[model samples]
Target chain A: MMENEVDGLDKRKAYILATVVYEYIATGEPVGSQALTQKYNLGVSSATVRNEMADLEAGGYLEQPHTSAGRVPSDAGYRTYVDALMSPEELGADERRRIRDEMRDARAQLDEIVEQSSRLLGRLAGNLAFVTKPQSDTQSFRYVQLIWIAERSGIAIIVTSLGVASQSLFELRNDLSPDDLTRLSNALNATFAGRLLRDCDDRSLTALTKSCGFGDDMAAAVRAAFIGARTQEQPGISASGAQHLLDQPEFRDVRKLRSILRILEEQRTLYDLVADAFDSPTASVKIGHELGSEELADLSLVTVPYRFGERAVGMLSILGPRRMPYARLLALASGTAETLSERLHDVEVK
Target chain B: MMENEVDGLDKRKAYILATVVYEYIATGEPVGSQALTQKYNLGVSSATVRNEMADLEAGGYLEQPHTSAGRVPSDAGYRTYVDALMSPEELGADERRRIRDEMRDARAQLDEIVEQSSRLLGRLAGNLAFVTKPQSDTQSFRYVQLIWIAERSGIAIIVTSLGVASQSLFELRNDLSPDDLTRLSNALNATFAGRLLRDCDDRSLTALTKSCGFGDDMAAAVRAAFIGARTQEQPGISASGAQHLLDQPEFRDVRKLRSILRILEEQRTLYDLVADAFDSPTASVKIGHELGSEELADLSLVTVPYRFGERAVGMLSILGPRRMPYARLLALASGTAETLSERLHDVEVK
Candidate 1:
């Protein structure tokens, strides 16, 4: 279809293709030339519209489910409509206000912000939505604390620059008094305060501890704590509103539903998919077969990267049937990502 | 239907009801008497089975989608089948091995354990599954540490008795060196150690700090750190396999799908629902209307509480259509919960 594409469609053919795609998205049914001419003021007679529809079919831009039925947009047809005819839909004032309020409330913590953003996106787009927290490997150390809980056990708490925290309990080879533990913590923080936790090396940690007059036992404890914090699993990925997929007529078959469920259950695949979308500076819409999975062939993914400062830290996305409101979803994804980035900056400042 | 209950059905009626429910669950189609006699060794003629089915419908145990169609199990019919006829389905050795292996690997952390459990449950049941991490309020303090990070900022690290660690950065009102912060941390830990963080009163903390020879300025910092640690929000709730809901025939309508997506997006409602399921000691099967939501009347929830030691701290559940295989799901939920509990205990012990 790509090789057989006709370049530079005439104004009438483009108008007819856009009208057919819009109508199919609104009503999960194919559009006929007669209905398009009657419903839309295309400034053409039914006969002229019929000839354009036939031309669209010949160009592989439209497909007919049956000989007697109307025409539906092919993958190429949707691609053309998204690429040229559609304008980004502006969100209503009330919706903008609601999104702003939700983002503000969620700005207090990283987890809440991610969860809230996913929920709000799902609600606005009426599709399954997901957001990934910033990967820990990309985050710099904001603070690290080791607190002795038992005679031989202590907890290591690590907070990243992104304000995300993680903790783990470790067994100590030797017991250290509160004063000694405090000194060890201060020395460790002074060494790696602004560096990414992933970049902290064992030799530097040991050398820093010894230079600070800590014994071998304290160095081992510090090393264990640093290793625990650095080796912690990746930041979480959360998804919501999967039931939205059930509304699509294409998902009426149980097999399709099962395949989608399998994909959702496999977080690694979803994370990779969202991460790949960050290659684009704006919202990236992967329509139909472009999503690179046979199971997702009937679906479209609209993704936009949310950032911390200029660094693209994470992503938010909406997954729906290929017959989706691409312009509106793209606008929503871009707008929400911008709001979320601003809110995160505000949180960091406070 | 409850009031119209006919107690102590004859052996033949009981068999017919079980067969109808099982067949409906398997094929997702209404079961006619002729099909029932053809499929099962009922040892009766089709005419005899037809009469029994009519009686079952009159007794409110079955329903007909259409006059000419076969009968399907009503809510009351499912309730009867679950209570009286179904036996727990035993998982094969391979499944048990897979669950055990997954849980063993996940036992190192609270978040990993919850995520793994939800994924395992969803995969085994082929339904939407969720697990909530233990709430912070319910956790007792195991350790506390205060480390000064800057002239006006320090990080407070708190460890719960369950080995879950949380950290938050607090602003210091006055400068405290490494030694003074150590004394303050020790005083705070001695006062609140082994006690619920929520029970630490402001007056007690101030007095404890003063008695330990700390000035009013130092006392304020200690109080601030303790309050910050105690006030952290509840642990997160995670869900997986929500796309599984689309596989159900009952969700063919977009309206039904939208309502469910809305519910899933509202985390508070989902949290409350999972929390309520902890009231039971075993796997709870809340069928249809028993779930207490009109929108969820077509669904069933199979929930089991996972414990840390003797405390029931979290829950795992599978959500599916009401026609779900109750016996198999109940067995899977209980088995997974038991495996999770044992794994958590092993982690704590090590």
Candidate 2:
């Protein structure tokens, strides 16, 4: 090992590069070799550290913005640090309790949970925070109930198997008396209860209508409500502390800010992005170059999937400068997901 | 006129600058003085054009990214062009009709219209797009109706004075027979129909309970539904085509992209932005520096308020890179808002 130390400098070079990148991410500034040795106690002299930094630059992990400037992590360097050097610390009990308390106050509404989760994340990360509610497809339908509210108005209430509820209103043409309406309601429940709505096809609709013995007008109304219930499938998405993005140096350009604001206004794209993050179960880190958008290549996303009653249903993540503390962000994201899922399920059980 | 042109260098300069900006917007590149003179036939020599370009840069409206490169519009330059010099061409009949057709297909659903409007703005600007539905507070509640669906389930339908409808559901303690439920529904309509629900205070709640002649369990159920209906009151926001921002030059950095994506997920921020845009009646422009976020100073938002049957209910806008053709984007945003309102009103009328 001692013989190879001088001749093969690969391990020493890797250590110095890793140390510099770690210090840069922690401080959000350029890192010099002297600082790296001092901070990490690498047991190497400043000259050796400088030599390794130069070699790391040649290997594409570290970069010098100017001839005299300290070294900074290139995208490659950050990638290597994220992949090999970082280890996430466990979330402290106080932080976990705080997350649980915040989520508890949000009530059972999915939108509220999403909104609070984002806010909690933004506060925790001190960067931009984003969280998305479970997508409609991910939720199981518990039951669909239709009720007549007025002479011309009817309501459809859909309960998901996961305890989320949604409702929509439609107009009806029937002038049925209360007796007739009561009979129809009973008949509909008997046929439709305990059935998965997505599996309810045209045959099911027809069977529901015929068995209920509802008039054509009532039957048409039921079909319309059924269809409306199916398509009301959107989930809520929330972000917090986006203003904090402006506090970062990378967004100093007014043009860059405008582009970002415009991008933020498109929630559908964001919804898709967050949902895609959940496709991986464990904590996943998507850094610059991995996001597949040239505009997004300078950022890092830390995402972790969350469960609803043991089923992985959605995700929570943070999007920030690529130099973000990946180990901490990853830990925070994972802890948030696990705690949120557990808290939400607990609320439902109660 | 000739004397005015020669003496009024400011006006001519503005014209020449507007020309250069327009040409550059059409082709995402810097505008050289020679190209401006040759392509625009500015009746000036290339040398004179170069001198003017230098003056424009000095005025902070243009910049040279590299020493030998042609000039691009700085954020300030785009601001001046948007506010003072540029005159958007009127929408042709075909473009107007295309916008009308887009709104015509949205049917009677206001939610669908706002969603489609954002997409339309995106297609028009080739950038980010946003649309916000009317705030629930602005509208008065017209009716609340309850219908019994099963032994434990019932649906609550609410219609506002503005003709929009929403629904909710609740569980009941006692199984009110369908006949009794019908009586309760009728009793609710008799007392609450055509009255502003916001005007109905807790005093009215007591009055309603006394007047409905309901049993204790049934009264509790009705009150629950009433509170649910009156308390649910946030407007919806829909947006699309945010991914288009990725194609812009300013967000090419991965850090910028991540921060922007994070901000876009914040619904409250987006809702606030779009709501403020609707506070104006005509085409609204939120330029760099005006947008409150320094990160957004490189962006511009062109928005206009839209109406639902003569009632100003929402706003729709497009988000573009700061160097975008503001004149064209503003015109497109105006046309989109105007056409959407007209077509939606037509649907309402039908």
Candidate 3:
């Protein structure tokens, strides 16, 4: 790795900077030059160590929470360390086995798997974690059941191939009975059972259901509800391990904890966040101000997209204070993404 | 309303105690005798107020946070005030209208109505709030759809009349095609469209499906799954507005806030708490130690069971610090409960 990224710091100096970052994350305290020299095999005198720390601070990679205190890594410092100098810490074998086994053991429903993923990731990472349900753009119909309600209304419950349900209520164009609805439903299901949800465009749906004895009004209303549910709905997120944040030193201040919790509760915000992270095949790291949301300015997020088929449809994330063990957490996030992808693949085959 | 409940404290003395409790709730501070006499027209002198406060403290109705501090209401004090001396604060017409309108506007799904109720109550009550999904012990089947999967397994998706879903996976007794499952499903629905779910005991289920061309194994497995889902499943809860606790003065302590959040996350604990509160027709108040959970020793919970037809099946609750305004929150809890009950009624008729 080319280590001379921060100003005039050479490879040795960058190594010193990474050690400070790692130590601060471990102890939740600043790393002084004297303590650093004594604790790590830096092979340098205290005087020389002090001079390098001062330079690192001047270069904006290190900062002091208090004027007299030793240095902690700034956001820039964390970024550079994660990018160039640091090698990811190995995720434990037991943790990996547990993640795979629990996800495999989850119920066949997509909702159950997603919920278990969030709870497991949160416990493994020791902070808040969340997973978004896969986008339905490419999902095909597993089954559809149409039931006629009172008046001219009907309900259509569509189960996706991945075991998720999308249901909508709509007004029927004709006076349909339970028996008539059942016949029409069976015909519709036979034709579109394995077809892509998006394949039911207005023109094709009209042509297709015309043979099943439904008019333009009936077809249009039903298509509107089905297409609207498939396209307009952003996947909902499941969150877990918020109580873990209480033990973090930075979140001991109740205001910071509240701000983060408030942001997590907003569904639109979480949707936007995971959407932005879904394209990255590996961990996408956003630290402090780089997160853009003011409520998240004191925290960092690491996300990785879990795939279905070839599509990167959903993402899982870990949230922690800025002084987190980024190397291990980044590894864990990507690892979980792999596990979730495998589990989702089995969901279709199951 | 009783003349007195605490020792020999009479009508005049009880009114003085109630006044102190209200004043403390408003200011979040101890009510000094002089301050109380000056602010409220008690028709008595400062000397009388001071003497009465001393007697209330001695009689266990109030306590001093500090020796020299004025007086704050104890749990016993709050109980007496809510039970006898206090008149419930009038919930405004606008507040009642808002609750009704929001609940009425919820989509025709039991789950959506319950979730919306929790968010609305949490905002209106300005604390943590939750709503339990109505129990399915008495729910009747709206519709059931069966689908065949690979390797002799099938799924049963049952929808209750109130628009809640219960699904289960079971091993098939024979090699069933999708058409066979659908035909059998229709036959079953024809016979028992709106029957109570509990009517299908193991013995009756085997006998009924024997003539439908499926073996006892399939019938028994399917019955076990449906019955397990309907009977053993404690209804899941939806909670909202936990961030509101951060602003409460008593929760300003980080430890207190953590304890309450921890308790709120335990689904079983919440299930038990709501179950205990479900039989009461009015607002059920459990203060401090009455909550019976050590983590909730500093908190108070107010619950009111919402009804389905004539049976009490679900409850709504507010959790706040022990020093909450019981008079207003109690009215709001019961008010929200009424709004939710009406909303469920519409779900069925829709």
Q: Which candidate gets the maximum DockQ versus the true structure?
A: 3
True contacts kept of each: 0.67, 0.10, 0.31
Off by over 4 Å in 1: A1-7, A10-29, A32-71, A88-95, A150-152, A172-180, A201-203, A206-234, B1-77, B88-95, B172-178, B197-235, B246-259, B346-350
What local distance difference test score does each model get?
Answer: 0.77, 0.68, 0.79
**Candidates ranked by DockQ:** 3, 1, 2
**Each prediction's TM-score versus the true structure:** 0.85, 0.68, 0.93
lDDT of 2 by residue, A170-275 (tens): 5656665545555665566666655555665556676667676766666766676656555656455667766676667766664555555554556666666565
Quote the lDDT for B259 in model 3: 78
In terms of lDDT, the best-performing candidate is 3
Docking quality of model 2: it rates as: incorrect
lDDT of 3 by residue, A254-326 (tens): 8888787777767778777667776666678898888887878878888888888787888898888988888
Q: Report the Cα lDDT for candidate 3.
A: 0.79
Considering TM-score, which of the candidate structures 2 and 3 is the better prediction for this target?
A: 3
> Could you give the C-alpha RMSD of every candidate to the true structure, in order shown?
4.7, 7.6, 2.7
TM-score (0 to 1) for chain B of model 1: 0.87
Worst 10 residues of 2 chain A by lDDT: A1-10
